[model samples]
Every structure is written in C-alpha cells, then in structure tokens.
Target: MTDLRHRLDAFVKLGDFFKEYCKYAKNQTQIDDNQHAWLKKFDEILALAGHKNGWFTPENILFSLESWAELLTPSKLESWLMAYEVDKNKPKSVALIMAGNIPLVGFHDFLSTLITGNRAIVKLSSNDQVLLPFVAQYLIEMEPSFKDKISFADGKLEDFDAVIATGSDNTSRYFEHYFGKKPNIIRKNRNSAAVLSGNETKEELTALGEDIFRYYGLGCRSVSKLFVPKDFNFDALFKAVYPYNTIIEHHKYANNYDYNKAVYLMSLFKILENGFLMLKEDNNYASPIATVFYEFYDSMEDLKIRLSQEQDKIQCIVSKGFIADEIPFGQTQKPSLNDYADNIDTVDFLLKT
Candidate 1:
C-alpha cells in the first residue's frame, strides 16, 4: 500500500477505537488503568468535552462518535476516495477554521486535508476544543507520520497554502477579507429544512423529530424550517414530535424557548406550539432555537424552484420523494463521508490545491 493508503488504514483503526470508547461511554463503564493508554485518553477527552460545553451532552457526544465510527470504516473510506486521484506530491499546509455548533463539525475538512496528503493547521472553536485534538493524537499514535501533518493553532493562522473556514454570516465577511487572496472555502450560515406533504406516516413524522431536535437544532443539518401543504393539520405533526419534548428540560434550550415564544406573542405573530417547540408561519430558513419557521406551499413545482433559487442558504432537504437530492427523514445528521457541507466537494478542492 502507498503512504496515503497507510494513512487511511490508521484512520480506520482510530474509528474502531472510537466505536469501542463509545460503547463503554454509553454504558458508563470505568476503563481499566492497564487498558490501552489511548482508551483512557479517550475517556478523559469525553469528560472534558461535556465539561467544556454544556450542550455537548454525553448522549449527543456518543451519537456523534457513533456516526463517525459508522462512516470511517475501511470500505467506506476506500469508496469515498475511489473517485479522487490522491497524489503524493509536496503537501500544502491547509488551515481550517472549525465550527463548534455540533461535535466534530469540522472533522470532514480535517480528514480531507490529511487523506489528500496535506498538512492540517486546525484552529478549533472554543465550544469544541477537546474532541478533535484527541482524535488527532490517536491518528498520530496510529501512524506517526501524521504527527508532522497535524497541528493546532493557538494564535493567528499563518504559513498555510489554502484555507477552509466555517462561521456565521458575519464572520464569513471577515474571512473573505483576510483569506480572499488564498485558495479558500469560506462557508457562511446555512440551515436545513423539511417538506411535509400531509401524507407522512406518524412514524416518519416522529423520525423527523430527530432531524429537528438533534444537537438542539444547532447544526446546519438540523431541520430549522418546514414547508407543509396548505390546510396541513399541525396537530398530527405536534403529536408525532412530542417525544422530543424532553429537550425543554435543558436550561439553555428552555431559556431560548421561553424567550422566543414571548417575543412572538408580544409581536402578535400567530404561532402554534405544543409546549416545547414553536412553529410560526415564516419563509426564512434559519430559525431560532426552540422555534421552527414554516411556510405553506401551494405547488410543488414552485416550491422546488424557490428552493433551488435559494440553495445557497439551504443545507439538507428532508423529504421522501420531493426532490432528487432529498435526504431521508432522521438521516440528515448521519451524513456519509461524501456528503460535503454546502455541497462543495472538500476532497476535490484539497486535491487540486
């Protein structure tokens, strides 16, 4: 195998470790001191992650780990990379400005940089500082060659040939000004939406709750908006999604729910609520926490055109047969390695850079 193949094998091993650690974590089992040092370190990192960010609940962290574990298998890695010509030329330094909205949100970019034979200079978000570095350490231990290729930046990012930065719409402007001259992928705020045809089964609608409530709807893949047919009965939707009402128990989420509900009521905006999530008639894509903006569509063709026109602001579209690229309900958060954020192919860009 070539050096790149060796690196891919090391990542597959790291994925196996993540799977084992997640199993133990979910069971709350104590790791033996004599167990692999990496396992103990993984335990420490999981604890630190929860302590650093309240939203990084143990369940959510494990969910993220499980998703990655499923995606990083050797066969999956090979399939994802099969289309690209991973050259072993002089590797460029790729700087990554990661997001912390979801656990390991920027991992795809990190993996792309290394798998494509480039150095990664990662600047982690304060909200997500613990997990990726530990994964990097595991990769290094599995294949020492990665030690020189992986780095974490504490200060201004310099000495990089290309950059991949993800942030809110405001920060994207700053990134454009700073890194505009360099070959870069600067991503702004984007949100996902779901389309309801009024014929969805209760089970399917309930599954859609996962797309909305996962990570408390902080991830770009989380469904923040809904497009339902005219005369759609929201009672069924609310009843189906009632299982996720437990999200209100989280203080942060409760606070947002109360605040946003109060604002909408004071503004005299007609809204529907099931005591947990509020749904309002709006056309916007990015909804506030605990609230999902929704719109009524009269024609599927027109809706498709509008969605296509506004594709830049959309991430994943949750539907059964509405569009060719529609993601199945409840599967938005479980994106494969090839599901590049914003539909911009990171591996292809890295290979060319």
Candidate 2:
C-alpha cells in the first residue's frame, strides 16, 4: 500500500482502539502485550484526567474520544480528504499551539498536519498535557513511519514553516507578535449561541441543554448565549434544561454558579436563575461558567444581519431552520471531520503550506 493509505489505516486502528476505552468496562479481548499495557495506561489516564484538571471530566474526555472514534472511520476520513489535493512532496513542519480549555481540542490541527504529510511540532497547553501524547504513542506503534514526523516542544518553537495557535483574545496578541511573520492561523476567543423562536419542542430544548451544559460551557462550541424572541417565555427552557441541573453537583461548576449568581445579585442585575444556571440579559457571547447570557430579538432578518456582522465573534449558531448554517441543537460538540474550527479550512491551509 502507498504511504498515505498506510497512515490512514493506522488512524483507523487508533480509532478502533479508542472505541474500546470509551466505556468504563472492557468488552474486547487483549490483542497483544503492548496493546494491553496501553489499555491499562489509558484507564489510568481516564481516571486521573479529572484530578489533574477539574475541567477534564471523565465524561467530557470520553465524549471527545467517542466523537473522534466515530469520525476516524475510513469512509469518513476519505470523504473529508477527497476535497483537497494532498501534496506529499517536501513536507513542511507545522507548529501547533493548542488550547487546554477542553479535552483533545488540538487533535484536529495535529491530525490535519499529519494527514497532509507534514511534520507536526506540538506545544501542548499545560492544562491538557497527558492525553495527546498517549494517542501519539499509539499511532507510532500502529505505523512506525510517524515516529519521526511528530515532536513536542519544551520551550521555543523553532524551524517551522507555518503555525496554528488557539488561545484567548489576550494570548492571541502574543501569538500574532511571535508567529506573525510566518504563515499561520491564529484563533482567538469565539463563543457559540442558540436562537429560539418559542416554537421548539421540549425534546429539542432538552437537547439544546446538552449544547449548553456539556464541557461545563467551557468549549468554544458550547452555547454561552441565547437569542430569543421578545415574547419568548423561558418557562419551557427552564423545565427542559432541568435534567442538566445535576451539572451543578460538580464542585468547580457549583463554585462558579454560586460566585457569579452572588455577583449578579449584588449588582442588582435582573437575572433568571433555576438553581444551577443563571440567565442574564446581556448582549455578550462569552458568559462565565454556570451562566448563560441571553438577548431579545425583534426580527429574524435583523437578527441575521446582526449575527452576520458579528460573525468573527461567534462560532456555531445552534438553531432549527432559523439560519442556513445553523448547527442542530446538541451537535455543536459532535462536529464532523470537515467542520473546521473558525470556519477556516485547516486541510486547505495545510495543502497550500
């Protein structure tokens, strides 16, 4: 088989292995001593990731892994790559500065670099230090050819042709200053929002709760704000999202809920609370943890115009037939392989570089 095909096969094998670890219980027989050892290590990592970083809850990490497992199928990978003419000649080194806000957030960029036959020099965020390296080892074990192509940076990132960095608005300035000279994709803070027309069913709104509560609303794809009609009643929304009230049981999330609610109350801000989540009437997209900002919209056309004007500040728009590019209620976090972050085609960028 050709080298590219071999690499794709290795990723498929990694996906299959990941499926076995998606659950708390083991269902598959051991493949080999090395595989068994890796599975044991994976179990330990899954158990300790939350202890290492409270944000990296086992459910969220496994959700990420399961999403990747579903996306890494041979057919899906082939379809995602079919649009681009991958150039294997003279592979360039691509530096990746990953964000630690969510689990395995940088895997897509790393996958793009390697799938396009480029060397990947990853600078991992301290918050997400463990999982990717473990996956990298699995990949190398599956295909020895990748051994020389992937490297992690300890300090300065040097001798790279292009860069991809994900950070907050503040750190983006630093990325631009340092990596600006090179070809790069520097992503800053962006949040997702949901649009409600007051006609959504209880099931849809409940699913929308998954979009809001998943990852503790820490991921850029998590819905931090809502756009509802002026006459929209939030009673149904409150009822539908009640199932996720259990999220407040998490200590870190509960702390944020208590703290933000107290601050809003002290400021006398008119906010709606359902014990676990606070809904404040604000125009901002980036809301604090355990809080969701909401805005009232007058006209669909005007709202569309506003969203278009603020496209740079937004990520995914969760809606049901409200907008053309609206992501379904709960699928923001389950993006397909081609659902490139920031709507910038990472594969196309890599192919050009």
Candidate 3:
C-alpha cells in the first residue's frame, strides 16, 4: 500500500476514536450540574457550538454531526488531494492558530491535521485555553498514539510545514509578517449580515436572534448588519427578539448598549438628522449588545444594489425575505468541512510539504 493511503486509513480510524472521545467529554466535563444537564441534549451542543440558546435535543446533535461529516468526509479530503497531486498521509507539521470566538472554534483545524496525517502544534487562544486540553486528553484516551502528534504550546510557537492563523484585520498584519514568509492562511475581520424582507416567520426571526446574540455577538460569523425593505416594521422585529431581552439586562451588554446608544444620540443631535440616523436601530454588525442598528432601503432592488456595492466589506448575508435558492441566513459561522477558513483549503496548503 502507498504510504499516503496507509496514513489516510489511520486518519479514518482516528476520527472514530476522537468522535468517541468527544462524546465522552460531553458527558464528563466539569461544569455545574445544570450546565452539564443542559449539554446532555445534542441540540444544546449545537447551541453551544454555534453560540445559540435553545435546549439540547438529540436531533440537533445528530444533524450537527451529519453536517460536519459531510463536510469533512474522506472523499472531501481526497478531492483536495487530487487537485495538488500530493500525499496527505506523510510527514508534515501544521501550526494551527486558533480563534476563541465560539467554544472550541479551533477544533476543526486540529481534526483536519489529524485526519490528513500531519503533526500539529496548536497555539490556543488565551481567552479559551481551558477547554482544548480536556478535549485533547479524550482523544488520547481513544488512541494512545495521538499523544505524539499533538502538542498544545503554552509558550513560544515552533516551526511547522505550514500555518493557519485567524484574527481581526489588525492582528493579521502581525500574522502576515511572522508567517507570511511561509504558505499560510491568515484571516482578516469579516462581518456577517442578514437581508430581511420583513416577511420572515416568527420562528425564523427568533433563530436569527440566536445567531446574533449567541457568544454575545463576538464571532466574525455573527450577523452584524441587516438589509431591510424601507417600509419594514421595526416594532415587529423588536417584538420577535423580546424573548432575548434578558441579554440586554446583563450589566456588560447593557453598558455597551447604553454607551453606544448615547454616543449615537449625541452624534445625531450635533449634525446628522435624528430620523435618518435611525436610533434604537440596535448595534451594528460587529457585536449586538441588546438591539440591532438598521438602515432602511426603498426596495429589495435598492438594498441588493447597495449590498452589491459593499460586498467587499460584508461577509455572509442571511435572508428569508427573498428566496435566492442559496441558503444564506443559517450558514454563518457554522462552517462546513469544505468551508476552509480564510477561503483557502488547509489540506491544499499542506500539500506543498
């Protein structure tokens, strides 16, 4: 058998091992009883993974896994391999620079390296250093061999065959200077948005709220902006999000909301027209503390034109107002296996090794 093929086989076995480990960790993390119980539901796992707020249920977990598998399947990996004419299961060290916006956001990078038969040096985020080791330990339990391939660096970053780094636009400059010399994927800040025809059902709008409010709107994938019809009813949108009003009650979120609101009011009072500024429009697409900031457009055509003009600035757009056969609203942050970060495939990057 080819060495690459053997490594690929080992990776498939590793996936089974890690999946079990993940399942076990879910059952045994050191959270409070309530949080643990809440995690017992698979949907709860999805909500946790995606930073949403629904109770856990089996289907949610099942669908989440199904979606993950479809994205990261062996065939998918091989397709990437075919393009490069390179061996996936070979000696290569991959340095993963993880993002901490969502729970264990850097996990996909770990899995990609493992399944592709590469050694990995993980640089965990300071904001979320606690959870990754617990996950890595479980993988070790599944297969003792994995212990050698994975290393969580608490100190300096070591050299690797390739690199994958994620951060804001500002930090990207540092990443580019440090790792740009090598083959790398350094992601910049990209804000997600949603298009509202104002015709969305209550359930869909509530789910959208989950997308916006989860993680307190810290993720790049979080919906930071919305495009709505000029005559869209703001009251209905606010009412739909009323259940999440408790988020506004939190001191941190309330402080941010109040601060931004005050600044906005002052700016309007000084020069801009109050009506045109759209106070209480909620916060912009970066982080929605409690409410949204909205700008009305006369029609979908106008909104589309504006969105097209600003496509460079906007990331993903969620919409239920007009069906475009493209699933827009729900696809934010919840990345498919094929949805490589920074719009570049990591396995493809590794092929150079």
Candidate 4:
C-alpha cells in the first residue's frame, strides 16, 4: 500500500503532464513536425472511431481534451484521491465494458481507474478500439507506469474485483444476468434533454446548437428531446440552429437523419405541428435517428410529472424553468473530473470494493 501511494503521487503529476500536453495539442497550425505525426495518428484513430468527414477532427479532440484537463484541477484531483483513499490502497480490479456511441466514451472509465489506483481490464467495443489506445499511447510516453495499470482484453471477464459496464437496454439484461453477482456499476440507455421557457434569445438558442450538435447529436448527453410551452414558437429555435445544417453534409450522419426522417414522416403521414418531426414517445430515450423528438406541456406541474415518469430513461435535463440545478446538461457524459457517471462516484465505488 505504501509503495502504491508513492506511485499514485507520481501518477498525479501526469495531470500536470496532461496540462502541457494540451498546450501542445491546442495550436493546430503551430504544432511542430514531430507533433503533427502524433496528431495524424490521432486523426487516423478518429476516422476509425466512426467519425468520418472530420467528425473527429483533430481540433475538436484537442479542444475536448483541453477542457478535460481544465476540469482535472488540483483540488478536484485531491477530492477524487480522497474519495478513493489511495493510501488505503484496497487492491481491486475493475472490468470496464466500454461504449462506442461517441468519441472517447471509454476514457472516463480509464480515468476513473487510474485516478483511483485500481487495475482496469478494459473490454473495448469494436466501434471504438482505435481511439482509447491512441490516447493511452501518448499518456504512456508521459509516464510509462500507466502501462502497468491498463490492459486490453479480448472477450473474457474473470477474476475481477468489481465491474463497471455500459450498454444498451438489451445488453444490460445480459450484463446483469452474467455479471450482477459482483459489485458493478451497470447502466442501461440514457439520453439528455432540455426544457424551454421560450425566453431564449438568438445567442442563447445558438448555444443550444452546441448542446445538440457538438458531437453530431450522437452522444448520450446530446439533447434528444426538448420540452416547450404549448404555444412555444419553433421559428426562433430553428433559425438559431440553422447554421449547424453543415452536419447534414456528413454522409453517415446524413444517412441517419434521412433514414429516420423517412420513418418518422411515413409513420405520421402528416406535417409536424410546428414543422419539427414528432414520433410517438416510447419508453426509450434514444430516438430512431435524424429527428429531434420532444413533448409539449401546458404547465410546470405537468412537466414535472412527465419528467418523473421518464426519469429512468433520462440522463440529464437542461431546462430554463423546469429543471433542478443538480443535473447539468451540456456537460453530460463529458462529466467534470468530479462529475461521476450514472450518479455513481467511481472513486467511492472503487474504494468500497
């Protein structure tokens, strides 16, 4: 335990290393020749990670990584370490079943295990196998010890001290049936949403474009549904978001939007009430594709009732008047260094194990 604590303290310095790494990462044009080589590798991995047509642009990855570094403040890291009690050093292994819905979804599990001083056996999703290793490769250059903490595994989950698994609802059943006996942070489908008081101006509404299209609306934290007052005007909202139509040019994204738009149009066989697609709300938070689906409410009480009914399906809700302060939306799944996933503090979870 004493030796591990010293290693953990040394590992903590990597946060400082990442801070510098991010500085090198930020200036795309200014990056030197050697830096460009690594950035090119990252770009390749991004392409392999289901982000065609600059979806995983080097600039965006750098920006997101910078934001991640900023969130890993000294106080924040101290709190995380305290939560895990690195000195106590309860040696445990965590099996992380990664998700590929968005770029770097699996990295949070990696961050959790590393900061908590737990050995992680990662099960990489086929769709995201490239990005995680690429990031880890650079981190290992910063500190070779990281190599001892992370291992890439193929299709086997045994001798684990605990598990953290993320999957669709169907796969969740399988995870639970197979892995429930162990201490686990198992999760099912979740979507992010926002509520409107109809008071937003063009600027604020435009930021909603970030909330919706930042990752092309593929993220669990992406705003899927919006709650609006019964007489809410869609004109202003649509106009604010029109600039993001560039997203429609990406072939894969366009395919999702076009295909789902076709299904929605065919199913409704009518123009939407406000010209936005409306599909029958289901028990699912994930919509079929290509459509922004939402429900209308006449009163705040009604909105709360609706939210309570759908709470299990929701991940985060962004609202002007109806939302509580605890759940932040734009920052969903791109959680703060302290912001735990599925409301479980990973450091705490690991320490308890």
| Backbone clashes under 3 angstroms, per model | 0, 0, 9, 1
Report the C-alpha lDDT of model 1 over 266-350, residue by residue, as the tens digit: 9999999999999999988999999999999999999999999999999989998999999998998999988999999998888
lDDT of 2 at 324: 84
TM-scores of the models, in the given order?
0.97, 0.97, 0.71, 0.85
Per-residue lDDT of 117 in model 1: 89
The parts of candidate 2 lying over 4 Å away from their true place are 24-34
lDDT of candidates 1 onward, in order: 0.92, 0.91, 0.61, 0.68
lDDT tens readout by residue for model 4, 1-353: 45454444544554544455556555534555756677566556655654443456555555566666665565666665664456675777889999876667767778778666777888987766777777677766656677787788897777788999999889999999999999998988888777877887787777777777766677777777777777887878888777777666666667776676677677874424222223344434576545566667788887788878877777777765565653443454356666656667777777777
- Candidate achieving higher TM-score, 2 or 3: 2
Query: Candidate 3 lDDT, tens digit per residue, 274-323?
Result: 21112245434553344445666677786777767765556667786453
Can you write out model 2's per-residue Cα lDDT over 1-353, one digit (the tens) per residue? Answer: 87789889989998888887764334545455656777788988766667789989878888899899999899999998888878444689999999999999999999989988899999999999889998999999999999999999999999999999999999999999999999999999999999999999999999999999999999999999999999998989999999998898899999999999889999999999999999999989999999999999989899999999999999999999989889998899999999889999998888886
Query: Native-vs-model 4 lDDT?
Result: 0.68
Best by lDDT: 1
Candidate 2: 10-residue stretch with minimal lDDT: 23-32
**So what's the TM-score on candidate 1?**
0.97
Clashing pairs in 1: none
Model 3 pairs whose backbones collide: 43-57, 44-56, 224-285, 281-292, 281-293, 282-291, 282-292, 282-293, 318-329
Ranking of predictions according to lDDT:
1, 2, 4, 3
Which residue pairs of candidate 2 clash?
A: none
